[model samples]
Target: MVETGNRYMDNVSKLISWGHWFSFINILFALVIATRYLVAADWPPSLLGQGYMLVSWLGHFSFLGFAFYLLLIFPISFLVPNEKAMRLIAVFIATVGTTTLLLDTQSFTLFNFHLNPLVWNYLFGGEGPQATNLLFIAIPFIFLLQLTASGLIWRNLKTLHQKKLGPVIATSLFVAFLLTHTIHIWADASYYRPITMQKANFPLSYPMTAKTFLIRHGWMQQNEQEKSNRHTHPGREIKYPLRAIEVNQPQPKMNVLLVMIDALRADMLNPTNMPALSQFAGSASTFNHHFSGSNHARLGIFTTFYGLPSQYWPDISDAYTPPILMTQLQQAGYQFGLFSGQGFLQPEHMQTSFNSIEQLNMAEPISPVYDGDTQAVKQWQQWLNQQNNNGAPWFSYLYLNTPTGMEVPPEFDGPHQPTSTMLQAQQAGPESLIKGLFNDYQNAVLFTDQQLNRVFTTLAQLSALENTIVIVTSAHGQEFDDTGNNNWGHQSNYAWAQTQVPLVIHWPGKTPIQVDKDTSHLDIVPTLMQGLFETTTASRYYTSGLNLFGPLKRDFILLGDEENYVVYQADRITEFTPKGNAYVLDRNYHELENAEPDIQVLMKVLNELRRFYPNN
Candidate 1:
């Protein structure tokens, strides 16, 4: 029995040796095939970027080959211990892997996106089979090549082992892999565009980020890290507007006052929670079915100013390009007064929306967001009074965050009963705690509403209400486990509770009509461009949105952050992740088994996302 066990162990060892040699050969093959990806992607302009590209390519594919060997061949070596059966299985696995890689490369080359279930269904579902048949023909050739290589590696395993080059090759690959991650960490911390921009070039490549680690060790400061994350590469170029904006100056230039409340949910605007804002909405052109461009303040505000999807954020922010809306406002001689409860440095709005404004007020005050809200309101009121005296049409942006912080002053009693503090609710479990937290959110909203009413009263006192275009809306909606899935905050999902917000537009001459049509924060820019500036430029040139007051109809709403987005239809939501994978969920965000999105709508969405780029 001992002799038999020794023989079996020897066989397994030999098979393991053969597997390494096989993996090495396949790694070469994979490297050759992966060149397709390099050819398809935008080559880096810098020498460092090119060096990173080469090393990452070598390390990534080497890792994949060894991973496959460990996962598939290593187990089989012990189980089967038969060279011929192992060779056949190995060949089959290699063939399938290679074929999948080939298909992904092709997909990436054509679409600039990798293969996912949604893309697979779209590529092979209907008439796609006929178009893709030519690509499928290469699978047999791949299988034959893998089979021949597997047999050759097995036959020469002893000679390869005697050569003893495996250790040297393995060490080189390990070094290359380690170097790749190290360079990525440095590049991410430094915000090196040439290196950082290639983050999504390879599929499933999640390179290491050292911002937090460096900050912990005192290698980097918190403010420096925030700037690094938000700073866009100035080297990159984009065609924003696609053409120059032509504005026919209005007869009487209208002042625009855009009031954005943080974490103000649509449901919180009722008579009970926010009586002041609800009463204001009754007189203004209120939108019942309105959505923010994103579930977070940063991108939501970006979409409002840029009139574009969040996908363009990186490119636009990288260039430090102000939105066309802001540029138009500046050119039209609109004086700017921007105030935010939360500092703009964190989101780097000063680098994007307010990039062109000289000496902009980025924030009012920092701690206890309630105090910041009060200061912001006071500052805006003072600015509005000054603007009333000046003849120039002024633009004032007041961003309040008291509701987002869930804070209220001690003097003002919260009418909502059974309310728990944010800390109390967070420490407790998620059953009835969500209800108490929600009541707390209502109290916060009520406090914010009172602040907003102060602005309206000031406007009425100065008689600026007749000439100012006062638009009240939230940056994004706050969530409170409305779906009962423990989703208690924004940026978690694209559900109604997180995306929906109230839009009350008090246009000077427009009738006070309640609009039930679907609208977005994106529409704000286009509406202002058409109404105030009287710009003849078509909305499509710079915006993905239509005029909110002009024949508003939408088949779907596109809402998301930088990496992932959801195409929200009336019945179902199709969420696309960073990897391009699609998840079909019902209205309440419950996963719907075997459901797919409308292909036409997805096609339109893809176009909308890519249209702003220089070459689409």
Candidate 2:
């Protein structure tokens, strides 16, 4: 009878030890969740059969890590505990985690289809948050049950002569993972992409590890975030200081006219047929290496106009503030007008910033249709004439979308065997019916350039040419390769062809300063401000923008597509640099990428931002 009792006690002791380690494993998974949430600012929802949503999109990545960790460490959780019970615990932890992921995903989908108006709308027909009620209940049981079981088992092991290394390693990883899961429960959490940021300064951690990260990464070297911004804004309070100093450049009140020819490439302009743009490029400060924020018109327009890079805000279409240049110019009594053929319906966010928004008011397509040069020339001349009616000098923002149509690839390249979804859609457009569609598309671009010529001619005719600073650029660049790598459309891929854009600044009063260095579309705002206010500007006080007219040359241009992020180094234009290397593109701005090159960081952030803003 005494021998039987000893065996029973041994079984309990072993069971307790096993539970403790298993609990730690569960905690490790939790840490992964926390870390992702800290970086992403939320959990991932499952996708397809799994959970996935904007805020929770990073979970897909976390899921990969979790699976790896599980496969490697899970078997050990049962080394000392009941094998059947340990398996059940594993199932419980996984099931609950999976549930959380899926619930988050479902929330995003429902929010997108039901709450968003930008897409062909769908209604919320599911149980909504109520559908995941079971997950909330299961999560705690799985988490707490393991936590309690772990503590009891740890006490039992101490009583016996038990080796704790296996338990220690397993439990340590588990706890770290669990804590990581909860890292962002606090407000004002900032995420750092170790590779993309010039300084690999990650923000916030628990007592034992926080200082270590800051010290190790040399976070103090260039702590831009710690610098006080406090710019002397005209009407608003910003972070960057633009006050208590005067610059010799033109005042902020200078009548500045910015024209964005959608999808205009650097080589797209020819001086002979499109002499006006060529004149601007020749006479003005030409940025032969200017790149756009995104390859899409929506992201391009917002970034170039607002003086904020597209990577900062995922949902560009919803950001409504006027481009700092326009806002400052307006404060200085400049009239603003935005003319587009597609109507502001696409970049609907334009309404909040643009003073006058006019589309292609058509009873019928004008004889030349879409991007008609003669009609554009006539209209621009008339609009240029109208600027004088209001005693205010004008700051015109013209966005022309004539050559904006997509073209079918003559070949195939991409994820599948050529789904060609977008190309097929483009084939249905009017360009498809036209002979030599690509040639016609090129002609449309030439015509658009010609129309811009009319604006220049009218400016000269009105004698407004000498007084104005004309900026000729494009929102995004387009593509036509049927290559397998085609992400389809602008800004979708991280390739140079998608983001490279034309930048020409013709300041009549200044001597030629050829800016052949790499520059971003965001610099347009600060550069214009330098010409106008002759001062600095930032979102708060520490705006990262460099003065467009400054002598600084950038070695890298940080590029982001909703799913991918990369720092395209200017000096190494022909090749990719070692990841994590900091490089400057133009004066005043530098970019950082991680040691491990993963462009997906930008893509994930973009997807999340899209999910958050407008809940779309």
Candidate 3:
């Protein structure tokens, strides 16, 4: 019995040695397959970046292949001690793994993103087999290759073990892995573009960052305020506009004033809630069915100015490229007076939208919400006077933050009763709390309308209302537990309560008519470019929007920030998260478990996301 036990131990040791050799060969296979990712990625410009990319490519896949062996095949080798059984199991595992890698590479190349369970279901579920038949065809060949490799490695196991190069190769790979991570840490801290930009190039790659760690350990010191003030610039090249803009300036260039109210819901604009604004809308071109490009403030504003989807915000912001509209206005000799109740530093609009403007006002009054709103309006009035004296076509942007803060002056009377403070509402029961919170929101909107009245009164008094083109809209709509899933605020979903905002445009010499068709903030820039400047350039050249006055209607719209977005069709919304998870929901935000994404809409969305890049 003791002899038999000793023999079993000897067999286990030999199987482990054979497993190591098998894993080494598979690592080589994985490395060769992973080259597809490098090809799909934007190549690093620096020599050091190129070297790091190669080293990381070699090390990452080698580590993954070895890890797979240890976790799945190493234990199986002992359970089934026979060499033939081990080879069959290893081949099957390897084939499945290799096939998955191949599928991921294809998905990444086409979509500029990787695959997850949702994407996998889309690829192999339902009619997906028809779309991915070619990839499936390669599976049998992969199995045969893995099988042949397993057999060769098994037959030559003793010879490979005798050579004893395993330790050298393993050490080299481990060193490469460590060196890549160390380089990423330094690159991230120093804001080194070449290496830092490659962070998302590799699938399942999350490089280390040491900014907070270094600060905590006293190795680095950075001013918190200055860091917050700094804007993010793009790490890669992007061709915004795709080409130079050509436009014929209108004979009598109208002064444009765009007023954006924070968290203003479309439904709240009525005789009861916002009397002054409701009256203003009656004489302007009011869009009853309108949506902001995103539920988030930054992206919503970005979309309005750039006339592009929110996904491009990061690239545009990072590149410090002002929108085509702003540049055109500048070239037409329009003076700019930009004011935000909430300072532009947080979203860093000073670095993005108003980047080209000289002597920009980045300061907002440090006071109560009511005082801030009052001051912003006063500043705009003063600026308008100065512009009128200069006799140049002027463009003014006034952003109010009253409704978002849900605060009003104590002296002011609110029509909405039984309203609780935001904190009080938060502490109340969920069902009862929403009503009170919503009441508070209504009162805030009422106060914001009063400020709007002041602007209108000033324009009329100066007789500028006839020549000035005024646009009243919101950056994004607010939410108050409208989804019933305990979603209390914006950025939670792309539901109507968060995306639908009031859009009332007072274009000079144009008929004031209510537009009931689907429209978006994205249409704003394109409208100004065509209607005001008479630009003959096609809308597709610089924007993903149609002219607001155009007869063509959009069949669908997109809403979200950089990491997550939803494609809103007529009856359904397909939401996608950063992790590649997707959910098909009805118009009411209820998930439809059996529903599939509309392929046509998704294809259009994918095209828009990639078209603005340097190379298609």
Candidate 4:
């Protein structure tokens, strides 16, 4: 009787052990699938995800300290393979992870997943069952898997302990996964790399969002008072909208919203390269004679923001300039917000004017550079809704950095590559490859344009479309296959590719005025004023840039490395690429041969930049 009773107890223990072991195995397997789907959705790219990594990294280091403490307690290289022990670890992980999911709901700013459910408020936010239902099913299944795995571990404890170190190895792996976020906080790297890169919005939004949140919650009260005060003609204190101030007219404020597509060039504005984008642009004012400011992103940013002339601030860093566009809008009773793809706090280019700047960084801390910007946009809209009662018009800037910032050329994953694909078409030669690269650029451009369609759609849905003025322009065109110096992107000038770009303006409820002459980003700030205020045209009154609504002073646009110190300009008929200090001064950029007058103007702009940026 004693022997039979012991046998029954032993069998019961084995079954319980198997149940826990299988449960764990199932959970671990489920983890792999969760990671896979997250990757497939390209989740990080749309989240504007960044800061999660820095926090995660800090968590990893903490775990490491805990692991060493555990080593001291056990002294045996492994924990005893008791099913109870494995079950304890499994329960620990699932409990912490699920609790995190529940606690994720807070102020919208804190809702990174946007799955916050305000069960208490009828009008609070949450849509469809996407993230919520996913977690709902995932958590239970994960628990079941963990339970089974724990049971399996129990049945073979004694012999398995003699041979294998699976528990230690598994724990170590979990620790390693924890540490990856540290790298994310500091730099850009993905664990499942080459798979997708856009990291979280650490450097991009940490301080910016914190600051904006405080300000949004009335911390800006001190600054808000400054906004209400205006200086007089002699810098005397005056009330805003002074009664004695001269008035041309009281015009309806057209809430202008500008979307600057960074690193975008013109040639890609088409059907084959960018079909969806092409369709979007077809409805707006398209200008054939648009050129970018300076070479690329940094330089282009300064010119468009301040209209200080690319001659003054080249990279928007380490140099000082006068008041800029965003500030001017604030002076005129407008609220300015920016949503960008570049790290908002680094590289110095983005540190300039704005009331608030959203994430505009990455999807996760360890994700790629061009990934998270779009999520910043979604957050921007949510924020707008919350602040709708602020009683002032708003100017929001959404700058996308995709297709343009990919480390490699664009990729098309539908129906495979068509017969005319760049790969097949450019097999001819290096020049052909260059052409293919150009083709790639255009395809990315199209991708960018298609995304804008979403932006417009969202704006219209919110009743914010007609009350806004939208301007679309690129920072600079890119040089491919070293047509200039074997370089493959936006930092230099080559022909018809780098300096020349496209520009468009679509004012809500206003007529689209097309121009035949030429315009560059320098004209942006002033032209923006043109759209809002009916008085002083951008170029004629306060700014040096020629107004699109006024006379055209430039026929051929200027191009330079720093400032076109050594000048180059092509006439309407010339066709030759210039060496050394180069410029395209001819008509349609056919090429120019030693044109003197145009070259002189180029030299003047160069000298002007030097005068302003003397210390730089």
Candidate 5:
């Protein structure tokens, strides 16, 4: 019996030793995996930026990983108090953690941003059968991968129980993580050197509030805090609530028609290219210095609807942020007809913008469908003609994406023959090719004007123009390498070429006039609300926009994109970037290298922006 007992003890010792070896192997394996994440691009714009990115990547990820190990995984391994049981728990945790990390890597590759609520909402929220089928197909492969990771983790944990080196290595990793993470956050806050901000959406990142702290201490400008706040959601307490709208006078029941031509630059509305629109603008109220709420379509549309900036999208989306605008219109019995060139009411949550919206199922044909601005417009015309004259006021939204896609009928494609097509022109680096691209964009505008003429003629034929308030604008403007750094897209920059768009309002009883005061897309909904309801001018202050007929709110206006926020006042424009970079430019979009900033104007603009977000 004694000899048998000794033999059993000897076997147990061998098993424990084997477990230790396996644990060491997994530690090495995990290190290799971590190293893959630590690797970065060699071509950072600056040496400081390169170092900041590297340290931030290593420190933030490593620290986060070590924290999980110590707080969650390690406790589970030792708390069980049974060698075999502890090993089982440890293996399970390690497998899950490893799988999550792998999945994150794959997600980062697929989308520039990290895995977040937005991605999940897009993937599984409404994709229906496709998302389900994809999950079904992936389950088997994921299960096999998990099993393989579990086997490795089991061996690793068994071996780790026999050694003290595990704790020592973990301590070393934790220390390194702390050092790098501190440097990353501090640099971002103090120097505005966007170290970790390049990956601001990295999984589980703590929001950076150090900039606010710095501002309070008088160590840094409040500009950083303002820009940061633009990305945050508003609180539960609504800033702009439903106030009783006091009307100035009695008004007739009128129909409102909004026609948005995508990427129509303010300078491009000419007698030559867009003759029809030019002729209409000549007799309408045109804002010569109008700017888009944002440089991109999604945010621009969000601003137009909410009468606020894009930062409010998340919170506002959760519950109707400013439900009063649309609800009031609906209550007043305004029939709505919403049309879009591309898919509208998407991201699902934005459906709140309209009360019972109807969409047209029209595809963009390869060839021009008879000089039409968009298939949606043609469908809308047909739908409009069929509606019974029920004497109810109506609101119709017509969106045309012509200059955006730069597509036109072959009949209208003459006068701007380029050396290459749009796709090739984008890659062709010559100045002439860039000019050719701009020419194509202009030709597209002309084609859209022709299509608008059809809509105008139809309205005239139906006598709808007599009582209709026609408002023409755009979601945002486009770029054609106008900035000289190969910036050929709308969302790429916040320069005048990308933010400036024309706004033309043709009120039935109002006379034609050109307004040079700076205006924005935010003013559209408020203007419509006031005009439709005959609200007093003072009520416009409730919105972020000023009444076109009232005094200007301030000298400057705030505009933004996903990556940039800008303040434009007078001829000088100030752009604030996520990486803490700020620059001033003249009206011509030329960088004013040594020009002194208008601090007063900048602060006023920033203060207005801070009102939208509570935290800043």
Candidate 6:
């Protein structure tokens, strides 16, 4: 019996020894991860010059990694006495941790963001099949690597007696790290500024709760004041499903057709490529210096419908806030129809806003882009024909994804082709093949123009043009390395090349007025309400825009995506980036090194943001 007891003790001793060694290896792995994060941050020289800031970030990451490993892996490894069970548990934990790291790396490469709930949904919820497939392919490799490491840990076993010293030391250090990190967060939050630099140091370090606490306690100034104002006002809960607006006059009984083309740059409107749209612009109210509410389709379309900035999207979408414009039109007895070439839910989760849409033409080109556009337009025409004699005011929304793919029929293909060298340079380096890419995009635009001609011709044939109000625009503009910064797509930046778009409104019996002043997508819903319904009541419910018929009331326009915001004024532009850096630029987008941030303008914008999204 004594010998049996001795044998059991020997086995446990071996297991504990293996556990400690493996735990130490995890600490080393944590160090490697911290190093990788620093490299990925790519901090600017200005930021690096802040000696205390640099030291704080480094110390924070190092302590975070050490604490996490000691608190988690060390406890598990040391406590499990059975050798086989310990190995299994350790391998499982390692696999999960490694997988998370891989996903974070991929997300940063693609979107300059870490993995979050929204991005996770996009990955697993049937969007970007090619990218998802590639991720799955790489998973097996990650698992194999994890398994090899686990094997090494198992093989390098040693005999060791049970001890409490290591656990006590590790636990104390973990507590100290936690206290230090919390204090750092509290100190940063009290300053009334975003903790952007801390966020960049490690993923998911936003200090959200700490900031809220500071604001609530009056420790912060700028944002705290704005937040206090929101709750103090009577009936400040933003009314949605907007109070059924009472039109003072009988609404104009006209067929409304809104065509939103994708990625059609303002400069692409030319006689050769977009002849139809250019000609249409002549007899329509053209907003020549118009900008989108955002540089991406999700926010752009939301802004047009909601008449608000993209920052309000989460509130309206998550709560299923039916667009006031749509609800008002519905109350006025208008039937709605929607046709989209791309699946409305992909890339942006727009289905959250337009919840009642049942049928969608979510087909893409199997060969040529024109073929797909042709089919979508024909389907729209058929749908329009069915509504011809209903005698009810009708609203149709057509979203074309033709130019989004930058493909065209052979006959419409332009003369430029990217050379092999140019393609290689673009893929490997920062050089852009702009000429070739623009040619392809423009050819696609030409094909889209032909499709537009077909729609108008069909409307004329059906006698719908006599009373229909046709409004034409694009969701956002495309980029072609315009800044020589290798930005070749929309939604990647808030530059003018990506945000500026064309807006042409055609109301029956209305004079064509070309307005060259700056305008924005926020002006759309209010303009339609005033022009078509002659109703101004919806403006009372926190609408961020004024009717286009009035003089420009705002001296500046706001633009943004998920990660950054920009304020564009007459002579200059101010950009607020995710890493807490502010950039000032000239009208032409050239950086002004000596320009100071316009704090008043920034504060005004931030106040509006807090007013709209108090809880975010």
Ranking of models by TM-score: 3, 1, 6, 5, 2, 4
**Tens digit of per-residue lDDT, candidate 2, span 338-421:** 554444544334333352333323233333234333444465567778876665677665667666653212331222222234
**RMSD, each candidate, Å?**
4.3, 16.8, 3.3, 24.2, 18.4, 18.5
Question: Taking the tens digit of each residue's C-alpha lDDT, what string does model 5 give over 97-207?
Answer: 655655454444333334544334444556322633354465456456545655665556445555657668656656656656566556556443334335453456563
Candidate 4 weakest lDDT stretch, 10 residues: 230-239
lDDT of the structure predicted as candidate 4: 0.48
Model 1: per-residue lDDT, tens digit, 255-357? 8999988888888878988888888888899989889999988888998999898877877887788888888777777888888766666443776888888
lDDT string for model 3 (413-524, tens) is 8878667765474587755566777888888899999999999999988889889999999988988877787776788888889999999999879999888877888899
- Highest lDDT among the candidates is held by which one? 1
TM-score of 5: 0.60
* Ranked candidates, highest lDDT first: 1, 3, 6, 5, 2, 4
Candidate 2: C-alpha lDDT: 0.49
Error of 6 at 433 (Å): 4.7
Query: What's the CA error at residue 152 for candidate 2, in Å?
Result: 4.4
Poorest lDDT segment (10 consecutive residues) of candidate 3: 225-234
Pairs that collide, model 6: none
* Number of backbone collisions per candidate: 1, 62, 2, 52, 5, 0
lDDT of 4 by residue, 95-162 (tens): 44433333233211121122222321211234323454454555666566556555556656556545
On a 0 to 1 TM-score scale, where does candidate 2 land against the true structure? Answer: 0.55
Please state the error at residue 422 of candidate 5 in Å.
10
